[model samples]
Target: MDITAVNALPYEDFVNIFGNVVEKCPIITAAVWSRRPFVSLNALEAAISEFIDDLPESGKEGILRCHPDLAGRDLHSGTLTRESREEQARAGMDALSSGEASRMSRLNEEYKTRFGFPFVICARMNDKANILRQLTERCGNERAVERERGIEEVKKICRLRLQGLVLCDAPNKL
Candidate 1:
């Protein structure tokens, strides 16, 4: 949709269009809606980023918790959103060998146990092996540090999703 159409969309329509950008966090899209008439896709992104930056730690953790583990059960169980499934597949997550899958599952569990939240990365930006390596490395980070890193990863995922939703150069003329 064009930027003008985006700016004019009703709240429900806006949520339907962009809610999946942040997993199931419709609140993020809703908050961005309140700051509408985005001059460009960059403005829309800035609104979303500001909202995320201002969110309480609990809210940030809740958003992080909404994402599924990479190459994990959600992929096989059909629990992930279509966007997530496609992104994971693009990152070679769906083609992991049995051994690789098992290793990822273990690391996911370990990472969760250590950080109190699932490990998150912009899967579209990295292959499965690199994801696993980061998971292993991040598991050793201090809890607060890991939580902040997870939030940053979520921001990256959201930015990519928004790029898919918004026209990159269109001005909002509404």
Candidate 2:
């Protein structure tokens, strides 16, 4: 899954590898997949940023939909991934007290009701407290702002995940 291998993949194969996430963040995924043998992690990250920068508002919304709800503990098919679930577990979702679970449930409902989508965050490097804190703070953002922010968060997550999966930060050419 290094950059050379990733870039060598057929476009359809690349799309399939990411599953539904590709459709949600096409421009970013496409640019990343198309950029072969990235010499540095920064170069790959640049591609991602450029892709996000060029997306239309509607397309940005599509990208935002790729992320799971912040700290979502329960499995609901289509949403579970090994990496995400592992991160959730690391965040202590498995040991939530009943009261904490209730609060999270209510907060999730309120956020979704207000924003028209679930609250999204890049939980890759975050533990449970970080996720919970973000969920609480984000509840205060205006809908329009949160929508835009959600897309950015997804972009961040994709970059981190892609770095771990594909980029190698080598200086040699592919």
Candidate 3:
């Protein structure tokens, strides 16, 4: 979509297009709709990042919690959002072997128990191997560090999703 068209979208249409850009957080899209006449796609994305950054710890954690676990039950049950389904497919999450899926499931549960939120990475940016590796490695992190890392990953996912929906000279992809 063109930035001009994006700026012209009614709030509902805008949300319809962008709502799940940050997984299940339509509130974020609703709030940012007021920041319209976005000068560039970058400014639009900045608004999203800024919104996420401004949240208190609990709110930030809430955003993370809304995300489905990579390769978890949502994917198995075909309950994932289209954006999530595509992102997971990009990371080859849809094709994990039974053994690999088993390991990922175990590590994901352990990480959530430790961190109080599911482990999140920009699946579009990393394949299954790296995702598994990071899940294993990041499971060792303290809560604060892991929380921030997950938020940053959320931003990366947001950027990519925005690029897909809004036409612009997207800045270098992360």
> Which tens-of-lDDT digit does each residue in 15-124 have in candidate 1?
99898888888888888898999887678888888888898998888888998988888998989898899999999999999899899999999998877789999998
TM-score of 3: 0.94
Candidate 2 stretches greater than 4 Å from native: 18-41, 71-79, 167-174
Kindly report the root-mean-square deviation of model 2 from the true structure over all alpha carbons: 3.8
Instruction: Please give the ranking of all candidate structures by lDDT, highest first, separated by commas.
Output: 3, 1, 2
User: Looking at model 1, which ten-residue stretch has the lowest summed lDDT?
Assistant: 165-174
- How do the residues 1-174 of candidate 3 rate in per-residue lDDT, one tens digit apiece? 667878999999999989988999999999999999898888989999999999999999999999999999999999999999999998999999999999999999999999999999999999889999999999999999998999999999998898887644444431
**CA lDDT scores, all candidates in order:** 0.86, 0.65, 0.92
Candidate 2 lDDT over 7-73, as tens digits, reads 5678777766643343245545555676655665566667766777687876666666665664454
Please tell me which predicted candidate would have the highest TM-score against the true structure: 3
Q: Please list the residue runs of candidate 1 whose C-alpha ends up more than 4 Å from where it truly belongs after superposition.
A: 168-174
**How much is the lDDT of residue 132 in candidate 1?**
85
Clashing pairs in 2: 91-128
